[model samples]
Target: MERETLHRYRDIIPDFDAFLQAIRSERITAVRWNPHKVSRARLIEELEECFECVEEVKWYEHAFRLGYEEKPGKTLHHILGHYYIQEESAMVAALVLNPRKHAVVLDMCAAPGGKTTQLSALMENTGTIIANDKAIPRLKSLVANVSRLACLNVSITWNDATKIQAKECFDYVLVDAPCTAEGNLQERITLMPRRMRESLSRLQRNLLAKACELVKPKGIVVYCTCTFAPEENERVVSSILERYNVKLEPLKLKVPHAKGIESFGREQYGCEMRKTARIYPHHLNSGGAYIAKLKKRG
Candidate 1:
């Protein structure tokens, strides 16, 4: 683990010691019920008989927190695609997008399809979701999961999202851009090299810019990352705000989190940075995420 890299945010991250400890502790297991397949009550009742604990996540009714030892993948419910085992915090971006039924949406970097499936459930399989991913290897899981979850609305596409030319077509766009994965400290934290950091930062911005272009007038775009790096989160957002005609909106989540720092080191992101949300592991006893919601001008 690169403590030095993460320690740089000590001043911004609340309860720094607790944040560090929380990341080091075991990650909680969480699953979202597939409303398209099974009723929540029935799933909960069945899950209770197998796992020693089945506590629901307060903010999200469809999700539940299980004990550390609960291997949800090994259960029949998972096999039947009645539920999906996802990192609790990963569920937020989809809900934040909150797409309407029959709307056209895009998951810019959708792979391993957690958020895509969730969005399908939220839309109740009524909309068109172009779940695009660049890598072929990752698409295998993306295809499988979408199929397993019976997401009839999702259509898989292989493309470099930065080059996607579907301009002003989608009602909503989600840029769950790939990042350093610093938030998954429970597994391991890889030291990000300067070259890699610069590369990823550029990629994140390009992907976001493409999302802005792809969304219709007055549409919504949600940019999310599992890393805490400002270069990838707020900095990328700030750059987009400067170049695009979009407005930042405050995230109203029911979970514990800190507002995005307006200024990190010498860079100033302005007051709008406060509208973004940063979820640390300590906040949900799960993984961490940085989420920003933007609405395009009509």
Candidate 2:
């Protein structure tokens, strides 16, 4: 881990010591039950057989934290698509989106379909979801997961989300853009070069701005990333707010999280940045993420 890269967040993150400790701690293993395949009770019953601990994550329904030694991915139930081995914090995006049944939605950069499958479960497999990824190599995993989870209403596509030629075509759009993933400290930490971060920021802004264009008037667009960089999170979103007709909306999430920072370094963002939520490793004993919900104006 680059100490300097993380030290930059010292003043911005509350209880900085706890944040550092949580990032260095062993990652929590969690899974979300597949409502399309099995009932919660039945899945928990099955999970208990393989792992000694199967405690529900109180903040989110159908998600549970497993024993550190237990591998949920190896279980037969998992092979059958009974549950998804997703990080607890990663589940927040779909919960915040809350796409309704029978609505039209687009999941831009939806490879490896964690949130995409969760969206399908939330919509009860009734709505249409266009699951897309720009990278051709990643689509295989996305297709497999959507199938395993019984996401009957989903249609897969391969396209650069920023270049999609759709206009006002969806009721909801999810821009879970690719990022530096600084939040996944549990995996490994590496120095992020300034040039690379800037390049990703440009890509993120384009993808999110395109999402705003694709969503219908008064429709929702949720942008999220697994990194804590304000350049990628707040700055990119602030740019969109300036150019687009979308407004930030308060996220009615039940999970514990920090509000987005209004200022980062010398950059000053609008107070509305506070409406966005920041999930820290300390908050969930999982990974970190930043989520912002926007509604296109009529």
Candidate 3:
């Protein structure tokens, strides 16, 4: 991590030392069972022989936290589409969206389909999901995951989410916006360039605005990111609330989390910003994430 980046988070993150320690430690590997393809009980029974430990995620019935030595993807179950290797915190967005059966949904930036497939499973393949992404190349992975997961309800499209033609058509929309990826310290990737970070924040704002526009009145939009940066998380959602008729709704997640910051630097966001949840690596013993649920007012 950069010295400047460490300094930036020093004041904002409480227990900064623990946060630093957590990010530097090994990341927990987790996977969510594909209920569409297999029963959770049966999957766990099958994996019991292979894994030293396979414990269910208390918050999500279909998810399991694997032992450190477990290689979930290499298992026959994964090859057969019985499960998805997803970070437990990343699953929060789809769970927060809570797409109802037969409800129209949109995954604004749905490539590599972790949340997209999860949405399909939640809907039980009954509703339609317009899964759109700007990058055509990434669509292959998206398509593979959806196909593997047997998600027939999803329709893939290649386009910028901000420019999508559909308006007020979806009951639920997810903007798992691109961000600085500061929370994914487990990957050991370089810090995002300052220029790219600024650009991504702008893109996140536009995508979230479009999500608010695409959902029906009284519908829900769930915005989330894998980074700890408020600029990409709460701040972007705050910007959307200022420009749109959406109100922040409390996320009813069972997992451990920190409340979103109402004031970042001198700027104070709406009080409702506290409804958002911020998951740190230290808090969950997993990668970090931020999630906010919003409802569009009529």
For candidate 2, lDDT tens digit of each residue in 193-290? 86778999999999999999999999999999999989999999999999999999998889889999999989998899999999999998889999
Clashing pairs in model 1, backbone N/Cα/C closer than 3 A: none
Q: Which parts of model 1 have CA positions greater than 4 angstroms off?
A: 1-3, 187-190
lDDT of 2: 0.92
- The estimated TM-scores of all candidates read 0.97, 0.97, 0.95
lDDT (C-alpha, whole model) for all candidates: 0.91, 0.92, 0.86
The whole-model C-alpha lDDT of candidate 1 against the native structure comes to 0.91
- The CA lDDT at 192 in model 3 is 68
**lDDT (Cα, tens digit) per residue for candidate 1, span 153-184:** 99999999999866799999999999988888
- Tell me the tens digit of each residue's lDDT in model 3 across 1-298: 3533544777777788888888888777888888889887889987786688878778888888886745678888888899899988898889899999999998999999999999998989997998988887899999999999999999999998889887899999999888887888753534666777778989999999999989999999999999977778878989888889999998787888888888878777777888999998888788889999999998
Candidate 3 versus the native: TM-score? 0.95
How does candidate 1 fare on TM-score? 0.97
Worst 10 residues of 3 by lDDT: 1-10
